[model samples]
Target: MKLDESLFTVPGVRRGLRFYVTGPTPCPYLPDQFERKAFTHLSQAAPDALHHQLSEAGFRRSQSVAYRPACPNCNACRSVRVDAQSFSPSRNQLRVLSRNSDLIRRPVEPRATREQYRLLKHYLVNRHEGGGMSDMGFREYAGMVNETPVQTALFEYRQGPEEDSPLVAVSLTDILRDGFSMVYTFFDTRQPKRSLGTYMILDHIRNAESYGLPHVYLGYWIKQSPKMAYKKRFQPLEVLDGPVWRRLEEDE
Candidate 1:
C-alpha cells in the first residue's frame, strides 16, 4: 500500500500553515525559562529526500520523532556538527582516550536489553535524577532503543575477560549517507574517572573517519548549558548558521 504523503505537512509562515507548538514546559537545557517545540512526524514511507530536507532545515530526530526549533521568542539552541576528519582531541581528551584503551567496541543491530535498561536507570538516577528521562519505564527505554526507520546501531563498550566483560556504555546512533548522528548515550555513572562521555565522542570521530564519513552530528550545542558545553571542547568544529556550517577558529 502506498503511504499518503499529503498527511505530511510542512509547517511554516510562508506556507500559511501554522506549525503546532507544544505548551510551555520548563527548559531542559536552561535553568528556569519555558521551552516550546514545533514538530512534524516522519512516516516509515518518508523518502530519504524528505529526511535530508528536514535535517538540513534544522530538524532533529529521536526514535521516530522529528522536531525543529520553533521557540516563540528564543533561538538559543544551535545545531552543530563536526568535520570528522578535522576534529582533533585536546590534551585532556587524549588522556581520556588513553584511559579507555582496554575497552573493546562493537556495533550491533539496535535492540533493547534488560541489562542496558538497568544501567540506563542507574545512569539517570546518579547523574540526571531530576531530568526528564529519569522516570522512563522499561518499555519506554525499549522504544528508545528499538524504534527507528533508518540505519541505526548501538555501539557497546565493554571491559575485561572478553566473555565476561560488563556493558559499560551504549550509544544510539543513526548512520546517514554522509555522516552519523549521535541520538543518545548512556553509561555507568559510577565510573566518573573513565569519562565515558568524552570517550564516546572521540570514538565516534574515529568511527566516522574510518568509514570515510566527513561529519558527525553532535546535535544541539547550547553554550550556556554545562551539559552541552563539552561539545564545543572538540575544537575545529562547524556550527550550522542559517543554512551553512561555519568553522570556528582556535581562539573561538
Candidate 2:
C-alpha cells in the first residue's frame, strides 16, 4: 500500500513517517460491521521515542507497526490503561492473585520456543477456535514474538516455583518508557476457574509498580464487546479521548 503523505502533516510527527489506511475488513469486535486501521511503520531512526508519542495518542504496536482503528462511523474501540501507582486490587482480584500464587512468572527474551508455541496452539484451539490467529503455525508465532522494533519480552507463567515447571500461561509485553503494554496473552483452557487471563493483567500491574512505571496499557476496551469488558475490572482505568487521556468514571 502507498503511504498517505498527508498524514505526515500532523504536528509532532517526523517528516519522513508515512501512514497508510487498511481496506475495510469484517470487524472482529462487533458483528455485522467492518473495520479499518490507520497505521505506520516504526523506523529505527527513533523507534522508542516515536512509539511513546504514538502510544500516548492511543496507537497500539503490533510487531514493528503502530496502528489505530480508522473505521468510519465506529468509535467502539477505546484505548485503556491502568494507573499502576493508584491501582488497588479488589477483593475478588486479590483472591485471583492468591489462587495463582503458586505460579511462577519468568521474564524471557523475545524469542519463540516450542513449549510456548505448544501452549499457544492449545489455547487457540480451545478459546479462539476459528479466530484470525487460530490457524497460525510455529513460524508465524515466532515472527509475532521476534519481530519487534521496541523493547519487548515474554512473561511465561509456569505451574510451580521450579524453573522447569509446566507452562500455564504467557504474556507478550512491551516495555514502554512510562509503562508496560500487554501486547497479547494466552493461557491453558483447562482451568477456567483460575482466571489466569485476569491474573496476568494483575501481575503486569505489579511488575510495572516494581519498575516505577505509571501505567499498564491494557489495549482497547470496547463497550459492546464481552471479550473486552474484563478490562474494566481494573480500577482507576484511563481512556484516551481525542488527544487527552481521562479517568474512566464508574458509570461510564
Candidate 3:
C-alpha cells in the first residue's frame, strides 16, 4: 500500500508522513460546536513505534487511522488516562464489581462475531438511541473490529464460566506499549443494575496493574459532557497537557 500520492498535492503535507484533516462535523459531545480531526494513516510498514508515539501524543486509533481532536475553537476535549498504579476503587465501584462477579471476562482475537454485533445493536437501542453508532451494520462493525494496523484485542464478558453463558458486553481494545486504550465498548443495556460499563473499566485497570502496565487510556474526556464525565472517575487521572502527562487534580 503506497502512501496516498495525491495527499502530497495538498497544501499541508507538513509531517514526514502525510496527514489529513477531516471536514467539520457537529460535535457529538458538546452543544453548538463543530468538531474536526487531524489524522494520519497507519500502515504495517512502520506503525508500532509510530502508534505508541501517536497515542502518547493524544491520538486515538480507529481502523487504519490515528487521529485527535482538531476543533479550532474548543480545547475541552482532553485525552485522559487512568493512573493504574495509584487507582483505588471507590465504594460504589466496589459495589459494581461485586454485582458483576458472576460475569466472566474472556479475551479473544479482534475478530467480529455475529453474536457480538447483535448484542451491540441491542445495547445501542437501549442505551444510545440515535447516536452515531446506532445504525452500524454488520459489515461496518466487522471492519471496525478487524481492520487494525496495530495489535488489538477483544474482551468479552459473559454470565458464567460456561462456554454457552450469555454474552453481555464487548470491548475493542488497542494494545499499547505501556497500557490499554479502550477503543470502544458496548453492553447489555437491559441490565442497568449491572453497571457493565464501569465494570469493564475496573477490570482493565486491575488487569493492567497486574501485568505491570501503568496506564489505561480512556480517550477524550470532554469537561462539559455528562457522558464523558465517567472517564474522570478512575483517578488519579492524567490529562495530556501538551507533550506532558500531568496529574489531573481532583475537583478539577
The lowest-lDDT stretch of 10 consecutive residues in candidate 2 is: 1-10
Best by TM-score: 2
lDDT of 3 by residue, 26-141 (tens): 99988899888878888846687778878888889999999887776678889999999899999999999999999989999999999999999998898889999899999999
Model 3 regions lying over 4 Å from their true place: 1-15
When summed lDDT is taken over every stretch of 10 residues in candidate 1, the lowest stretch is 4-13
lDDT of 2 by residue, 1-252 (tens): 344443344456666677888899999989999988889998668898888888887889988999988776778899999999999999999999999998999999999999999999999999999999999999999999999989889999998878789999999998889999999999999998889999999999998999899999999999999998899999999998876789999888
The Cα RMSD in angstroms, rounded to one decimal, for candidate 3 relative to the true structure is 4.9
Q: Each prediction's TM-score against the native?
A: 0.88, 0.94, 0.93
Which run of 10 residues does model 3 get worst, by summed lDDT? 5-14
On lDDT, the candidate that comes out on top is 2
All models: lDDT? Answer: 0.78, 0.90, 0.87
Q: Order of all candidates by lDDT, from best down to worst? A: 2, 3, 1
CA displacement after TM-score superposition, residue 102 of candidate 3 (Å): 1.3
> Which portions of model 2 miss their true places by more than 4 Å?
1-11
What global local distance difference test value does model 1 have?
0.78
